[model samples]
Target: MKAFWTLSASGELWQHLAISSWRALVGFAIGGSIGLILGLISGLSRWGERLLDTSIQMLRNVPHLALIPLVILWFGIDETAKIFLVSLGTLFPIYINTWHGDTQY
Candidate 1:
């Protein structure tokens, strides 16, 4: 307990937290932007729905973890891999919710 509290007060812990928070924010922003754009396109226009909706739905059904091996192979063990993984994981929920919101009204 003492060690943990000391570490939490240390600069290293703060730095690690800052880096993680930044990564999460960036990943979410990228995922949300893509999802919002796609949802808007599909929900607002007939042509866009025809062109993008089926594909989006299909991709949404895919488990994000299933892509981990490919992502690791392609991106290696880098920060980009972490961000990309997070973005991919977040994309489907945002996309689905945005699509539902846009279409419901």
Candidate 2:
């Protein structure tokens, strides 16, 4: 607790917090945009739903942790990978919820 106070007083805590918050914000924006677009398509069009629903459902079933290695391999251990992983984690919930809300009669 004392160490936390020390870091906070020195602004290190704020810096780290800001970075994390920024990452989450960026990830959420990216994920939410894609989710919204896809959800609208799936909800509105029977052909679009047939095209996208299966793939999105499969993605929703896969755990984010299980994709860490693949994300790393594909994007390398950089900010991009971190953002992508965060986006992946954020994507499905928004997608699922939007789909449900938009599609259900």
Candidate 3:
């Protein structure tokens, strides 16, 4: 408990926290925007849905863990890789929810 408290009180903790928060927010924004746009298109146009829905659903089902090696190879173990993984994690749920919401009404 003492060590944990000491670590929490340190400047390094805050810096790490801020970086994590920034990554999360930026990733969410990118993923959410793309999901929303694609969802809207899919919901509004039958052709768009036919073209994209299957591909997206198929990609969504592929496990994130399975892609980590590829992501690392492509982006390396850097901030970009972290953010890309975060965004990819967020994209499917946002897309499915937005598509359902747009289409149900």
The top-ranked prediction according to lDDT is 3
All candidates in order of lDDT, best leading: 3, 2, 1
1-105: candidate 2 lDDT, tens digit per residue: 998999999989989999999999998899888888888888888898899999999988888889889998999998899989778777777877877888787
Q: Pick the candidate with the highest TM-score.
A: 3
lDDT of 1 by residue, 1-105 (tens): 886688787857788889999999999999888988888888888899899999988888888789889889999998999999888878778888887888898
| Regions of candidate 2 where Cα sits further than 4 Å from its true position | none
lDDT of 3 by residue, 32-92 (tens): 8888888888988889899999999999999999999999999999999999988998888
Query: Clash totals for all models, in order?
Result: 0, 0, 0
- Which model, 1 or 3, shows the larger TM-score? 3
Off by over 4 Å in 1: 1-3
Better of 1 and 2 by lDDT: 2
Q: What's the true lDDT of residue 78 in model 2?
A: 83
